[model samples]
Target: MSANTDSQLAKRTDMKLFSGEKLLVIVSLIGFALAAGIAVYISIYGAIILPEGNAESAFSFNAAMGMFILSIAAILPVSGLSPGKRASVRWFFIVAALYSYAVETIQHLRGINPRFSQVGTVVDQIAGGLFGVIALLIVIATALFAIPFFRKRQPGERPLLVLGIRYAFVSTMIAHAAGIWMIVLQSRYTGEAGNLIVLHGLGFHALQALPVLGWLLERSRTDEKRTRQLIHTGGIAWTLAIILIGLQTALARSVFELAMLPFLAGALLLVWLVTVVIAAVGLLKIRKGSMVQTNTVSGEENRDLV
Candidate 1:
């Protein structure tokens, strides 16, 4: 019965996505749903695992719920997006979501907690990684794929407010990805997991840099060089952050500090989080004053033989 209902629901969803005039709408809806689901999972997990009085636990529960609400609010508008943006960007989001799923599944199987070395910490890390991955995947795939696609397809399709809506979505995605890196760091002490952790961490956050390009794509339209520059700069920053993390993990000599190598990792996590916010907000500011305008020649109505 459940399987049948799920299939039916999926069919309904496909119909809505395929038949809908605006692909962006479908993209937004999917992204929104994905984000909301992550938030719920996190809130539940925190309530169950962490003690009632833990600040991180309580804050995460609150944060997840707040983010879930924000996702729904962001998804409300699906009417004004272009078709090209819809399919390409949406596909990117779906792929990213799938990739994150794979990453989390692997983590669950192999993820460890040096602090406890017990089943409880292992379970917490696995669950947390799973929940965090979904949120990061949706946010990034949408911005990196969908936003740029939309900007190109209908360069002047919507107003500044609309563009800002797009940036807000992207910003949230970067923030979530940055947060997930904290989970990645948990597994870094293991020599075997170190490389994988750093690789995935950088790869995931690399998507964050892509948004600066997406925002630029919206403004310059065809200035591929400028877009490339933004993406390149973002890539450099992304790589450096990963290097900082990798060096910290690889070079640490002692187990130290309650068995949880705290010195460098904690500092790097803080740096990563701060930059993530800065990048998100920077894109938002660059998109300021972007108005919707159509292109038309001043005096060429009936004849066109240029």
Candidate 2:
């Protein structure tokens, strides 16, 4: 087939798979349920039953929410893969999600932290190691899936969405680095006040935040040039925020400290937030305009019928 024909064919295949994307949805729902269960458990016990200095509630809540958001975000890119690749990747996510839930819930219930727990039994340590391995696998898989986004946009592909995905993947890699740093140090703390968990959490959220910005811009009926500019602004600001946070953590300084680095990072985040608000406002205006037009047409039709 010609190159154009090939693109069209791939686009059709992607749409078909996108419509059938259910496994990831199921996995995301399961993650939500696990998170809810954890919340209920915490409420009933009034504590997470972990050692001092360890925030078990944060750990468990973050894990569950991470799985949920990751699975939901995976649906789009995974469906863009070939049929065989899609099935394999989908199953990999399902298994990983399940393993993560089991390890996190079981370890917490046993009064053993699932990650970086030095005082746990041999089994707990082994489970922690396996969790790290699973994390590595997920990173590799996400990197691989990101490849398609960097390629030439296929027919019917939204350029802004692809661009946002590329940015999101890069930010996610940075976040993963924070996670690895924690693994190496065997703690989430760097200095007296620097917390790697803050960096890690912010970094991972790029996966959702950037893409949603792009999606909102795309649907707002903005011109392509303006849309691209807005996306670039938001993407760069978000990335800079992550980098600044990482740098502060690496310097063993708290990101919230009264320091220049923290100030710049906070400012970048605000810039991104402003862009998102702009896109959201544009979308609302478009929707409102469409509704008024539809109402006007309905009134005209009613007059004709009368």
Give, for candidate 1, the lowest lDDT window spanning 10 residues: 47-56
What is the TM-score (0 to 1) of candidate 1?
0.32
- True-structure RMSD, every candidate: 14.4, 3.2
Q: Clashes per prediction?
A: 1, 0
lDDT value for model 2: 0.77
Model 1 agreement with the true structure over 1-306: per-residue lDDT tens digits: 688777665643432212442433343344445445545655675323322122233333333333333233233233234567555544554444444433333333343221223454556656555556565655555455435424532333333223333444443444444445445555334453333333333434333333433444444443446444444444444445454454444554332333334454445445545544544555555555242111234235434755
Model 2 CA lDDT for position 27: 66
Which regions of candidate 1 fall more than 4 Å away from where they truly are? 1-209, 253-306
Candidate 2 is scored at a TM of: 0.89
